[model samples]
Target: MLPSTYLPSVNRLAPPSDPSLEERYGSLHIRLLYHFEHDFYHHTKSLHPGLKDMLALFMNVGFATPYLMDELLAYSAAHKSILGQQTSQLYLSEATRLQTRALTLYNSASPQISKDTCLPMFLFSSLLSQHVIYNVSSNVHNGLGPILDGLTNSTIIHRGLVAIAKASWPMFSEQVQQQLIRSCQRDYMPIPSSADSRGECEVLLSRLNATDMKPESIAVLRSAVENLQDRFDAICTDSSHAMWAAVQDWLVAIPAGYLELLNQRRPEALVVLSHFAVLLYRVAEQWFVGDLGIRLIRLINSHLGPAWEDWLEWPNRATMEQL
Candidate 1:
């Protein structure tokens, strides 16, 4: 574990009650801001360099934005809660409190994505993405239904951040946009793995195509499968691409209509999703991912039952081996 100390420039950081910040959100928040940046910020950065660096460039240098700051604290606290800290309950309570407040503030804002708000909103959504996954996946006492629901929720959030990124992409300068695009495409979503999933994907596609679903539905699902294949190929062939980046990108890339298939509990859709669990399995050690890949595999397998056991064979085996 990294020490909870600030970098050399800690002296320049504003005191918790800096008049301007205190004026906006009071001394408690001012203290929370200082404590987070002073203690946890550097520590957290060491844990996820890509995440910390990205947010540092986008949000940290400025006075903490209300919602984003809450989320950062919430995420850090949630992580602490799981670390067997002596005050884990307090951290957990604070995590939940801050997370709720952050979401409320975010949802209450204007609907439109504007130049000024877009990047901040995007960063907020991005942090919230991992927060939800970490929060949901970490609490597993409820059984399969809640786990499935949590994953479904993560997928929904994944789609949302994708929308925000697409809308905000054009706002950057060509050079900066290219850099940001690389971040969004790779560092921004570290969910997939470079593990060989071609066999599983092929089975998924074969089963998908044989189904009697509507042409459009089949087409949508097929596009998603092909997208997976292309990504796996890229991961295998390209040295620059992060293998795990492909994990969440599938959820991000899939169209809304295809998600309806998952909502409807379509066997093919479930099967396709189960294959994505392979990506999760590949990166199961990641802090936010954990055993989620295995959980997703079990949920889908149990949900589909014997009828689709053959379809789930690879994903099921991949995750089960971890046990």
Candidate 2:
């Protein structure tokens, strides 16, 4: 095994206070915020003001709704798991129960989804998306199989976000309104690949056979890979947690046809997607992605084989050479 120092400090991120030994988790909410959310904000500096406000509402609102609270707990537990806490499974179990309660409330509570209700719905959905990532990443059998599943969760969450922002942007504070607008622009989000990796991406992209696919499809796929590369660059500059969130956002924002191609296991599509596996492998030490990245690289190789090995040359080396 490689020395732990070679990896990102994601797992070493500790919460602010000790967890409650209380079986009832009476301090669960406070612990969740102080430990997980605070640490995350400190490291990433990129979490939205809207989310920050929702968390505050979860604490102070007299009517601190069930779904909102449940999502908070689920997010906290999942974050704990990612940080390598020994009690991750225990926290995950509690998170699962709370998520179920949150979903039930969501099903029963919504005809109005208006300004008064939209923020909570948006926050709950966003947190649930993160929770799903933690859950899928932690499972032994999950590996590469959950890539699309995680992407699907992110896509649904993004749709909800767009709808909510359209109706409720007026309701948020001016700062939050600006933040939402910025997110809509997507220009300010961190780039995935670093300057050093640009050459690698160019090399990979150049190998694609344009004759085999339509120009439109090629354009879409090329855009997706470039964005992925940009995200890889961001990961190196920012905390892995922050950039991973951006990546999740990227998955949802990518052209819908990207997923369609992935579903078809098109070689060109997989080749581009394989680059993301290399990015994921960078954080393999974190409980979030675990060995899934390594598995994904292998899966890609198996799918493409020696015939297309040249296309995978950089990514295969990336996965193998990691510490």
Candidate 3:
């Protein structure tokens, strides 16, 4: 956990020619910038080719906007945390403050959204969402379903992306527009064949012989699992920057009734969610999901143990195979 000390705004203001203040302010940005470019940027570049262009645009926007720069620093700091650096906790605390300041600026702005602020807002939202996902995924001891609270941040990111696309598409240069299109194109993909998923789900569902189970509840969970399978296929096929956004939306995208049943701790719901855990396994190579899939399955087993072992047979087998 990061300490609550406040970092002064020495850097956010114009240089006062005070050597110490300048050094303190300038060094933070310089260090974070180096980390972003040389370390974080290169690692994420392969996530999507068009992300390279988006990052360039983000840098241009960040340099001009102090609040946005704060967000960028925070994001880079969070990225460093993901890399297992020892100084990450301090950086994480500062990242929280910086993100708060950026949001404060946006909220206090005039009613009419300015074109000047649009780019920063969009990039900040996107980067913040990425930071939250990466942060939560890397800290698995906190668990999965609860970590999904970060989805609200992701929702803001998606809305910001949509707003920018609708309002500013015509304003950017042809080169930038082409890059944006390529980035957007990578987000959506055809759903893959469902034969394997269906087979897997059927095998898992067949283990449930509890006569006391509600048929409607079972149906809802079944649908949810099937929906997760579809999403998993879509994510596997997608080669876009938007893929992470979709992954974040997974919880909300499923039927609400399905989630509610899970809240009730329906055994069938747990079984299906276990399979959703498997989807996480399939995408574990993606930094955004990381080892979360394996952890989620383990957590599920811990919660629903030997008594529910029959329901977990397929999921446990799948998880073991992944190991």
* Candidate with maximal lDDT: 1
lDDT values for all models:
0.63, 0.60, 0.61
Candidate 1: list runs displaced more than 4 Å.
1-52, 58-64, 85-89, 170-197, 212-216, 237-243
lDDT of each residue in 87-145, candidate 1, tens digit only: 77877776776776666555555336676676677777777777777766766556655
lDDT of 3: 0.61
Predicted structure 2: lDDT: 0.60
Off by over 4 Å in 2: 1-58, 61-63, 82-86, 111-113, 175-197, 214-219, 229-242, 282-295
lDDT per residue as tens, model 2, 26-124 = 676567657555765554345343445544554443136665765677676666655656876777666666555555456556535565666665556
**TM-score of model number 2:** 0.68
Weakest 10 consecutive residues of candidate 2 by summed lDDT: 2-11
Per-residue alpha-carbon lDDT of candidate 3 for residues 226-322, written as tens digits (9 for 90 to 100): 6666665666453434444455556545666765666666667777777766766666666657877778778778877788887788778888965
Ranking by TM-score: 1, 3, 2
Candidate achieving the largest TM-score: 1
Rank all candidate structures by their lDDT, best first, as comma-separated numbers.
Answer: 1, 3, 2
